[model samples]
Target: MKITKLTKGISLKRPLEGGNEEQLQVVRQVLADVRAQGDAAVRAYTEKWDGFTLQELRVSTEEIEQGAKSLDPQLYADLKEAAHNIRFYHEQQKRSGYRVQLANGSWLGQRITPLDAVGLYVPGGTAAYPSSVLMNVIPALVAGVKRIVLTSPAGRDGQLPTGVLAAAHILGITEIYKIGGAQAIAALAYGTESIVPVDKITGPGNIFVALAKREVFGEVAIDMIAGPSEIAILADDTAFADEVAADLLSQAEHDALACAILVTTSERLAEEVAQEVEKQVAALPREKVARASIAHFGAIYIADTMADAVEAINSLAPEHLEIMTEQAEQVAEQIRHAGAIFVGRYSSEPVGDYFAGTNHVLPTNSTARFASGLNVDDFVKKTSMVYYSEQTWANHAPKIARLARMEGLEGHARAVESRGWRKGE
Candidate 1:
């Protein structure tokens, strides 16, 4: 990694989806086939892609309990603790229906209702992310969603990672499915004979899964068209170079395209962090992936001042931002964009990723400018409530009719006038 002098403007690298065209086409064909043929299509794709024929798609209670028990007791306890913390934090975000009275005696409010069912996609195979399981499921559980269905790829042995199952068992999520990739997304969006369609799907996956989500969006709601994971650390002289390097590398190791940036007021800190990154990355298990990411997307910008650094942070709108400065909270207050903000030097990025109770499934690839982290709100729907009093209707119908007439919608005007309302009457 190299430290560069900050110019008037700086932009993050945007990589193209070069060879993903074929994967995208595959996703579309699978989605269409699944929508048409249902379970047979889903099973066929599972066999073709995952390389395992499925006699049973759903994981049974016995499997979940056995997996949970098989885990090291200490890890199981840690998962239990993490789940409790996640539930507590999300419970604070739960909302209730509200009604507001108006001068005209009309009532207006919003009724918050949990979606009937939701599908959570957890990636399996070599990546056993039980933490992701907790992050995705806890919010839906807090929002009072009735049926939370989980799907992940099974191993060559036709089994989900025990760690994932342990987390699911801890959360009491029973409807687990042994499928993954674009096919699992299709099964969630459109019902199969074995797998029922869900109202919404939430989780993160590879490009194929992402493109699948994009295709099935209108058919069933999706969380977001997520890209690669990324993070931006806004540090000053008070920040530690080694810790900063480690935190940045944490996100960089996620994938080859994952981005890690550091914006700082001190050129010395920038240089030190860059050196520290090289030194630390050499010792990582996923050093090859991190090296490629750093060589491609990682950077250090020496901003003129903290204000300039904040401007760059906002411009980038990174998924995870760490404010490690003298006044971390004050700096965070000026941040108008970012999926999640980690305040203070003690609040490393991974704390929020795992045990800190904050969600790790966040917007990536600058999508944080308009999107947010997965939370209780994603699992629920808001239906606007409107009730017009007789006097209120009489008072406003003529105005409404005129507005409708201005738009040449006479049927709309007539509908408004049908209540014995006419202009100046």
Candidate 2:
């Protein structure tokens, strides 16, 4: 990792590539082919990308039961506990419709309802993310989404990892499919013979899946276009260097492009953390990946003051921010932009990622400046509703017609005039 002195009014560019047009065009062609040929197109692409020829696209209940039975008893118990915490947290975010009546008997409000069905695209094969199954599915379930379907690339064994299947089974989601990549997204957006189209798609995937989601957004709703995982730790002399190094490597090992940054007011602590990162990274199993990520995107920034550190952090708008200062909570309260904030040394980012009930599906690539992490609200839609009684219509009709006329929309004026109501006084 490179060490640098903080400069005012400077912006840093991300080293990772955003989806290029070539990738977009490939996703476009795949989506077009799937929309045209349905199941046949999906099958061909699945073979091309996943390298698994499928006689059946969907996983059966027997397979799910087998997966459940294959899991270690302790791990299975932990999964249930994680799911419980995740569901409990998201249930608090669930919303109900509300209406407000006016003095003239006009009612206006919003109706909140879950999508009929949703598709969860879990990264599979080498990426074993059973935690993601719990993270994505639990929120949809909490929001009352009835039909939750999951798609993942199968390994050479022609089945999803037993743990992934077990996680789905625990959530009562049986509609698992052995398809992945851009094609799975295409199939989810525009239905095939075997898979019914879903109203929304969620979860994380590779660049192909991200581009595919971008292509099919209008056809069906989708969660944010996820990027590489990242973390930023704001620390002082009070923070333990070893713990900070471990947390940084935890995100760095996620991918070759994942970013890990440390911003601190203590130059002494910055040097210590950098040395600790070097020592700890040497022992990691994914050393190559962590090294690549740290070399390319990681940095240690020395800020002149704590306020400067906070300002720099907000400018970066990192996916995860951990404040390990003496006054961690106070520093956290001052932060205006971050996907998720982890306060103090004890509150590590992985706790939110796996077991601490918060969703790990966060906005990346500085999207935390405006967007948010996934929650129960992502699974539902809000529709604005209005109703007017006869007296209310009579009171407002002429005003509506006059405004429509002012906008030179005669059709709109005529529609209001034809409601058989007296003109407003």
**Candidate 1, residue 36: CA error in Å?**
2.6
Top candidate by TM-score: 2
Superposed Cα deviation of residue 247, candidate 2 (Å): 0.7
Off by over 4 Å in 1: 14-19, 421-425
Per-residue lDDT over 12-61 for candidate 1, one digit per residue giving the tens place of the 0 to 100 score: 55333323778878888999898899878878888887888988999999
Q: Write the per-residue lDDT of candidate 2 for residues 306-351, one digit (tens) a residue.
A: 9998999999998999999998999999999899999987899999
Model 1 TM-score, all chains together: 0.96
lDDT of 1 at 19: 33
For each candidate, what TM-score against the reference?
0.96, 0.97
lDDT per model, in order? 0.90, 0.90
